[model samples]
Target: MADTFAAALDDFTRRDWQTLAPDAVDDPVRVAVVGLGWFAREWALPGIDRSAYTEAAVVCGVDPEVTAAVAAERDLVGVAPDELRSGAVAEEYDAVYVATPNATHLEYVEAAAEQGKAVLCEKPVEATLDRAERLVSACDDAGVPLMVGYRMQTDPAVRRLKESVADGALGDVVHVHATMSQTMLGELGTDHDQWRLDPDLSGGCALMDIGVYPLNTTRFVLEADPVAVFGTTRSEHAAFAGVDEHASYRLTFADGVEAMCSVSQTAQHASRLEVTGTEGRAVLDPAFYEREDREFALERGGSRVGVEFEQVHQPAEEFAYFGHQLLAEEPFYPDGEHALGDARALDAVYESAETGSVVRLDG
Candidate 1:
């Protein structure tokens, strides 16, 4: 089964898959999507729809009409979100992709796990540490793989950065800095931006939305967990009443290395990651987004060298990797435990912000 799946995926890779529907391959991993929102519809579906190794067999969403329309457009079965929550739809697929809201991830993951389906959940795993831990436990108890959708982790440029750091090209990492911000709110109030301002749904503000990119990417590059965190947040605009408009946090790793990160919803569009070590420094500009051209640079010995990686389809790469792992029955990157680690760090960030003190993590 694995060999057949790999062969089909290889064939698809050789062709212009975006212009073609997913070929029906032998023993392809059937996937049920559990959200038809912006990311799910625009990014996730296209990836799965183009992959020969995975078949998007079903879709479920909050609105039946929207779900049905998407399913009809994609030529897949459509079901209500309630059917997925009830675990009735789990029998039709080998895995479920939970792209729902932050706070609703646990229930969907649990429902999929209960039916012994592999789960690909969106980042953070859950809004809170307790729920994140539970989500991991449920998947573990079900003996199924649980992967978090950290798309940047699969990007070629980001992977090269990870390799450089892991290979000790940058010796004795001392400090890391990352910033991700975007202008979400405008003079005219938008409904999409309003829901994100609600702490109950979004967990926090920009920290929960875009900040996790830096937080997770830093941990991935360093391969070290944070021991303590100090954070502060502010709501600069009256529109952001229930949640913060901007946040900055510093993480102290066990090796005495520190990472400073900032995230905002009312700032100019910027995303970058910089790592400085004893020997050299590495930088990735527009680090987290999917773009045709991305710049990565290395600085050493008073000289700077850089390279541009282009045509990176991160969503497709991520889903393809997940399908490969599922077929091989191997461990996947940024699994539930990995997401749990990030969730804990984020929890500490919130704690520190609220108390105005450094919060320590127990090893």
Candidate 2:
């Protein structure tokens, strides 16, 4: 936990946000959104409420449909929603959400940082180690927060898992095994391989895309950084072209406990995580992804350990919490700095994969 989080807890615990109207809070931040592609449609817009954290100042996109839809929905008064492009060079908005492809993350993020707006960048942060580092540095220099989309870290279930491990109920963290997968790859166009499928743009295939979850979650549950990594990769689908479709690897912590995991976009859709230690082990089904309706299990070796389940809090439900922190200026998520280190760890994973040798991260 960072000082900002500790301070936020101290400040927000006293506030009556619970009693305040669902729409009411302290001062609202002016929020701007960039890109209206998959994430904006499936998660973001629906996830954000107008009355919550920030008032929607402008919506930016290059696509006609996205612009038309966002404008029609928000009823943009001055600018056409479709007129906005990444970096949104044409117009300016207060806080920007960069939902562009993984490859484009750094450029747009730098723009938002330069524009002096809080940036909520979609995950992977960037395609390479240098890029993620530059984004973090720019945000730091600009005095802005660079938040990555590791939403599961805020989920109650995820919180409980981390707490349990922290309490030593899992004993000295020993070894961990986890997996995250989705549809192998999407077929976009005959000649049009989307940026995600392009190694130059996406940084990595499944490893950075869906693989980030396991990387983030394991670090959360273990409360440690992987000092070293050794791995192998494989690509089953043609979409991978030369990119690896599936990658499996092991991370060795300073304490000597290892995490052996597989990340794939080509296998059955499952987000499973298992942790083993001297005392017992805990398991979470579909661990990294938030599944509010389903239950997750905690266990000990051979024995059925009791696991308490709670309502998974959606970002929308929890976003107001962020607003309260902001109004108090206490810094909960406090912009996007929380996940910057995680992105760096992820970058190291790719470096190890590319070298086909055990790479030392922080050594």
The global C-alpha lDDT for each of the candidates, from Candidate 1 onward, is 0.81, 0.65
> Model 2, 277-305: lDDT tens per residue?
78767677767554334345555555554
RMSD of each: 6.6, 5.6
> What is the Å distance of residue 131 in model 2 from its true position?
1.3
Per-prediction TM-score to the true structure, in the order listed: 0.90, 0.82
The alpha-carbon deviation from the true structure for residue 352 of candidate 1, after best TM-score superposition, in angstroms, is: 0.6
Best by TM-score: 1
